[model samples]
Target: MPYVEVLAPQVPNQRKAALAKSVTDGLMTAFGVTADTVTLYFLPISPDDYAHAGEFEPQGAGQRILLKVHAFRRTEAERRAAAIALTRGVCSAYGVPGDDVAVYFLDRDRSEVAHDSKLASD
Candidate 1:
């Protein structure tokens, strides 16, 4: 199963829901996995939850978006690309202009995450 988690400052109820649904659909299509088997998580974090560290982010606190996705079955590179693309899609869907967004992906073998615990490979 593919696990996805997204974090961003609070947005309109309808917009947030639509963004989540759009992401879920994109992942299902990109990973060639069943829609039911994917576990998508969304977390909205305020300015306190973020810290800007680069030249572009050289300013006080502001709204930001973080997206992390973990999946079994694909290589790390593949997963990362998919995650980045999804983040871009989300940015466009939400009409986020000049916003900060980041996406990351973690890959592991299917056996790593079992029903209740991490397996030996983990």
Candidate 2:
């Protein structure tokens, strides 16, 4: 299972849906998880609240999306492949520069999560 969180500027509902789907599809393909096992949260941050380097501009940050994926442990090779797939999916779905799509993975032990009210360690 994977829990995905996206931080970006405001987006239309349709675009948000596409963003979620794009990420979900990428993770599913790369990690072999089902749709039900993938959870996504899109957080809209004001441009004033976002800054890059020594500047702050709404559109500057708006043009990019930060993706964080939390999931069970995986080999380094798998992690790299998943990052590439995630970046490609975001770029393809949103017409953004590949660099604009940032991906970070937070790997956890199975004991750290649960599913269907059952602990993963169970």
Q: What is the C-alpha lDDT of each candidate?
A: 0.68, 0.80
TM-score of each predicted structure versus truth? 0.73, 0.84
Write model 2 residue lDDT over 1-122, tens digit each, in one string: 79988887776888778877877877777888888888888887766776777677665654568888999987888788889887877776667888788888988898888878888989
Model 1 per-residue lDDT tens digits across residues 10-77: 66878777776777777776777777877767776655555556433323255567777777767555
Error of 2 at 68 (Å): 0.7
Residue 92 in candidate 1, Cα distance off native in Å: 2.8
Model 2 earns a TM-score of: 0.84
> Which of the numbered candidates is closest to the native, going by highest TM-score?
2
Task: State model 1's lDDT.
Answer: 0.68
After superposition, the stretches of candidate 2 with alpha carbons farther than 4 Å from their true spots are 58-63, 115-117
Evaluate residue 114 in candidate 1 and report its C-alpha lDDT on the 0 to 100 scale. Answer: 74
